[model samples]
Structure formats: structure tokens, C-alpha cells
Target: MATYDPFRDLERLASSFLETGRRGPREMPMDLYRAGDHYVLSTDLPGIDPGSVDIDVDGQLLTIRAERTLTTDDSAQWITRERTGGTFLRQLSLGQGLDTERITASYNNGVLNVTIPVSEKAKPRKIEITTQDGQQQIESTTA
Candidate 1:
């Protein structure tokens, strides 16, 4: 019989859920992808200014914090209110394969694009074999 480590699984599942949660209710919904030697994180932040958004990286964790201010005229009445705007914090633990120092970010068109360049040691390298008197050898080293 085998036993389950619920705590670890729960933590992993919770992390995964937080990474792929729904939009709107989730602040700064991001789409992450691997492009060549870099990882791309594109987030949708409608009605939010880039200046108001703050990005922080600590070790492998990345946090995006933003505050939204709402205003209305005195004559305006709120008959129905569903859009509750306020400050929100979102964070993700990036993989060790990333080069945190070289991370580049840009905000445009209501979308924030973050480019995480993979570390040289994290990228794939191809090795070739050469015959030297019936001996095999590696051709190159890359990361």
C-alpha cells in the first residue's frame, strides 16, 4: 500500500490554481509562454495605468501590485454596484531556469508584457561527436 502526501500535493495544486485562475476577479491575468530562449508573460490590466503598477522580484518569486482609484460626481448615484475596484496583489514563483536580473517588462495597450531571459545554464545545448582515430568527442557546449 502507498500513502499520499496531501500537504505537498495541496500546496502544488493551490499554486497551479493561483497561476491559472479566472480573469477580472483575478488581478492582472497573465498568459505565459516559452519563446525560443526566453519566457514571456503577458498580462491584461484594463483601466490600470503602468505607473500605478509595481513589480517586484525576490529570489524566484515575482509580485505585481497595483492600486486602482475610482471616482464619481456628487450627482451620480450608484443604483447597482458589482465592479469593486481596489488594490490587488499577485505573485508567482518563477522557475530556476530564468535569469531574474535580465528580466524585461513593458506595458502597452492595456497589457503588460514581461520577458524573462533564460539563464545560459538553463538553455539546451547540442553536442557533436567527432572521430579522432576511432574516438568520439564533444563538439560544443551551450546553455
Candidate 2:
């Protein structure tokens, strides 16, 4: 025999209310950081098909999209269904001095990795200084 639990029913009602009208794309968690002359962005996408991953860069905007689908069996009984399956999306506004043309991305172990390289004009460079006596001196500077 199953015992009556008011708390469980209340929790289920609250969850249903919170999840209602949430049919749009879900947001995926990501981490971005700079390592030397390049930036790396790592995003979590477990149980997602690698082929469904799509990434695009339009000017200074970078967009990432993916989809996840769960299979259900008609004869099998489900006790709980907490995991959601739907489209996941994330977008970022890229700053200047980045080589967008050379950007690359790869997926591995349910994590997507993106590499953004710094443009040559944006890298730190040395400047050559000329003295009054026509002598040349080298100085460190950033561009």
C-alpha cells in the first residue's frame, strides 16, 4: 500500500507551474577564458548528438546551437522524467582584435571547445626608437 504524501503532490504542482510555457530554446552552461594569444570557450552538452551541433559567426557575433532528443518506449513504465530534451542555444558578442576567420571548434566527450586566435595587429609587439644621433634603440610595447 502507498501512503499519502501532500508534500510530494505540492512539489509536483510547483514544478509543473514553473515549467509551463517554457517551449523556447534552453540555455547551455559555458566557460570562456584567455590562454596566451588565444581564447578558449568550453560548453557542456551531454547526451547531445555531435552532428546536431551548429556554430556560426556573423561579424562580431558568435552563435552556438544544438539539439537533444530523448527516446520513449510505449510499453515501458516511467517512474520519473526529469531530464528534458530540446534545443539548446548560446550566443556571445566577440570583442575586437580577434581573428574570427581563423576560429575553430571541436566536440569531444560531450563538451564543445572553441578556439579564437588573436589577430596579428592586436598582439604585443616591439617598437624601434631612433635617437638624435641616428642611433636605433629597441623598446617593448603593446599594440
Candidate 3:
């Protein structure tokens, strides 16, 4: 019995040319979401050298680039090649409230993790309310 996996087949057929040792620019799949006072981004880039990863920030644009190489002997024969080796590029538009100066990135076990912290101005804060007697009191905390 065989189970069907269209996604797996689609992904392989999509970038099969890279298996032939052709270099190309590909999008690195990522997940970005807010966690507490910061945002976390995780992308998959398996079989890539850590030193080949390049991260840069230009204005409010964050760019990430990396390369994966497949080295083999000249007489090597590939019966079922599926892994891709090429340059992976991705860019993100940072919002005005996000802190761009304190961004950090790390790679471990084929996954790249990036942390984007929220700025002080964008953080939620509580404001004091004034009563009719000119007395300041706590209104409520803002989320």
C-alpha cells in the first residue's frame, strides 16, 4: 500500500532543476508571528553551510540570503536526486513599530531563527486618568 503526498511531489517537481547543480534564486519559506513583546521568524534551509548565510538590513527592509552546494565526484551517478542546492533569498518589510537595530539571527540543525523585538513606543502602556477633583487615578491597562 502507498499513501499519496501531492505536496511532497509538488515541491520536488517545482525545483528539480536545482538537483542538476544549477544555481538559482529561490524563496525561503518562513513563519513570522508576534510572541509577547517580540516577533519570531523561522525558516528552513537544510543542507546549507552556516557561513554562507548572509543577513542585512537596509532602512526598514530586512534581507536574508544563503547558498547550498552539492559537491560530488565527476563519475557520480544520481539515481533519484531530490535535494536542492542554490541561493535562497528572502526579504521582509519591517513595520514602523518594530525595532530594527536590535534584530538577531541564529541557525541550528538546518533552521534559521530570527528575533525582532518591538520598540518602546509601540509597546502597550497604561495611561493615568484625571477625575473631576483633579485627582489622577488608574483607568485601565491597555493591551
Candidate 4:
């Protein structure tokens, strides 16, 4: 006879729940990284129409909402349903150092790319400093 660990089962159940939650409309996998003078956000939105996708930036929060409709009609008996097709809204909190007015977004193929320019005050600047020996040193500044 083998003993079952309740804690282990609980952990597995929790993990399964979390994985299912990630498939919801508001849940999306995203990649945000700094690129030159702006921050780029790349997200996967397969089977989504470009026109049905909406992207907006409010304050320090960026919101992306997309709708996908899928219809299937079979002439057989009733079956189980596991696929979800509807509107999904995903919101992410960006840094306040971004320039919301200058934000740019584009959708190609099935990927959505958002480029948010960093504010001038947030961008690194070269500050020249004069030393006692008449030497100059460059420093970077941030907002």
C-alpha cells in the first residue's frame, strides 16, 4: 500500500488552478524590455484580428483588449466544451517615466508590438563634471 501526501496533492491542485487562470481573457504572456530610447512590449495574440484589438495607455497603466469569435456547428450528438472564445482584456502597469502621448503600437501577423518612448527626464543624459585637475567626467542621470 502507498500513502498519499495531502500537501503534495494540494500543491498540484493549486498549480493546475493557476495554469487555468492564465488562459483567461485578462491573462496574457508578455515580454517587456528596454530598447534604446524606448521600452518595447511584445505580446502573443494568435488567432486575433488586428481590427478587433484595442490598445490604450492611461496614466501609468497600459490596457489591451481583444475579441476573438469562434463558431463550430457539428451535426453529431452533444459533446464536451473546453474552448473559450470571447473578449479578453489585459492591463499592465508601466513606469511613470514613459511618454504616454508618444506611445506607438502596431500589429503584424499575429503579434502586437507596443513602443513607449521614455520621457526626456527619464532617459539617461550625459552630465559633464569638471574635476580639480581640470579633467571632465561624464555621468548618467535619470528621472
Candidate 5:
């Protein structure tokens, strides 16, 4: 004979309720860092279709969106359906000095990588300083 656990059943019921309440879009986890003259932003989007991924920039705001769909078989019984199917969204406010026009993104291995290059006016360069003695010295400075 199989044993019946009321507590386990109650817990499962509560979990189901909570999961059903979360029908809205979820946020995509990401990591961002500055690399040389560019910024790299990587987001994790496992189980998401590459064709559903969309990236856009509006002014200084950058938005990323994707979707995951779960195919269900009505005749099959589900033991535990923990994986969720919904839209994934993330937005960021880019600071000044970034080359938004040259931004690029790629999706590979369930990861989305975005590269934002620094504008020419924001890059560091060597400036020639002329002294009163008519000698010129090179000084490294950031614009």
C-alpha cells in the first residue's frame, strides 16, 4: 500500500498556486563590464529561442526581450512542471560616451552578448603639452 502525506500535498498545492500567479514576464539575469574601448553585456537565456530574441536602443535606454515556449501534450501526464514559459525582459540606461549606433549583439549557447563601443570623443589619447621653453611633452589624458 502507498502512504498518503497531507503535508506534501498541501505544499504542492501552494507551489502550484504561486506558479500560476506568476504569469507576467520574467527578468533576464545579466553581467556587464568594460573591456578596453567597449562594454560587454551578457545575459543568460537558457531554453529561449534565438529567433525570439530582440534587442533595441531608444535614446539612452537599451532593452532586451526574449520568449520561451513549452510544448504540452494533452495525453501525457506531468510529474513536475517547474520550467516556466513566458517572456524575458531586461532594460538598461546607457551612460553618455557610448557609441549606440555601432552597438551589436549575438546569441550563442543560450547566452546573448552585446557590445557597445566607446565614442571617439570619449576615448583616451596623448596630448602634446608645450612648455615655455619651446619643448613639447606628451601627456596621456582621457577625454
Candidate 6:
């Protein structure tokens, strides 16, 4: 049993008209996770041209923008067209420990992958301990 909601269809119609090439467009779906010393973010932008994708970082904010357009022929009609083409936007707030300068992004198979490396200063390191009295020597490796 499926519920018929007229508002949902109206909302979808409004969104298709509202989204433009500018900002405030619909955002692409994504999944972010941490892997070892880096964080990986994967976003889905199906049927989008690779040249239309853009990634920019300012301060601690990372913004990803892309556009998809629906191409049609006048002869083809009388069918359902659910895939609305519009701009996609996504922003991420980076943390202090992230290495923003070396962030890399790649697009393949309609998916965009962004890798953010962790800063070296934030990684675990061994600290040496020593005695100031000059009579005792202590050597320890703490990871």
C-alpha cells in the first residue's frame, strides 16, 4: 500500500524550477570517512560532465560545485522525465588537523572522490624522556 502525497510531487516540481547555475542548488549525495592518515569523501554526480565540476578551498571551508544539464531533442516527447538537471553544491568545514593545502580530488565513473590528508603535526609521535640531574638516563618510545 503506497500513500499518494500530492505535496511531494509539487515540491519536486518546484525544486526543478528553482535550481539554477548559481548557488543554493541541490547538493549531491556523498559519503565521508577516515582512512588511516587521511579522510576520503565520495560524492555522486551522475550524468554530469567532468569539466563542470569545481572544487575550491578558502580558509577552513571546502566547497564543491557541479552542474548537470538535460539535453533533449524536439522530436522526442510523450514520456516521463524524472531526472532533473541542475547545479549541485556541497560544502565541508575542515578541522585544524586536516592538511588543506594538499587536498586532492578526482572524478571517475560519475563519482567524485576527494582525499584530505591529516597534518603531520597531528600524528602520533614518540617522545623521549630524560633526567636533568645528569645522573639518570631514561629512554622510552611512546607511540
Model 5 vs. true fold: TM: 0.83
Misplaced by over 4 Å in model 1 are: 1-26, 128-143
Better of 2 and 6 by TM-score: 2
Off by over 4 Å in 4: 1-24, 74-83, 128-143
Candidate 5's residue-wise lDDT over 15-57, tens digit each? 8889768988899889999999999999999999999999999
Clashes of each: 0, 0, 0, 0, 0, 0
For residue 89, give model 6's deviation from the true position in Å.
0.3
- On a 0 to 100 scale, what is the lDDT of residue 9 in model 6? 86
* RMSD value for candidate 3: 4.2
Check candidate 2 and list the clashing pairs. Answer: none
Task: Output the lDDT of residue 125, model 6.
Answer: 75
lDDT for position 121 in model 3 = 91
Question: After TM-score superposition, what is the CA distance of residue 121 in candidate 2 from its true location, in Å?
Answer: 1.1
lDDT of 4 by residue, 19-108 (tens): 557655655578889988898998888788889999887778889998877676777563444444677777989877788899989988
Query: Candidate 3 residues 4-114, lDDT tens each?
Result: 999988887666754555556889889988999999999999989999999999999999999988887789887777666678999988889989999999999999999
Indicate the worst ten consecutive residues by lDDT in candidate 6: 15-24
Candidate-wise lDDT, in order: 0.78, 0.92, 0.88, 0.79, 0.92, 0.87
Candidate closer to the true structure by TM-score (higher is better), 4 or 5: 5
Candidate 2's residue-wise lDDT over 3-97, tens digit each? 99999999987886666446889999999999999999999999999999999999999999999998989998977677778899999999999
User: Worst 10-residue stretch by lDDT in candidate 3?
Assistant: 15-24
Query: Residue 84 in candidate 1 has what lDDT?
Result: 40
Order the numbered candidates by TM-score, best leading: 2, 5, 3, 6, 1, 4
Each prediction's TM-score against the native?
Answer: 0.69, 0.85, 0.79, 0.66, 0.83, 0.79
For model 6, name the residue pairs that clash.
Answer: none
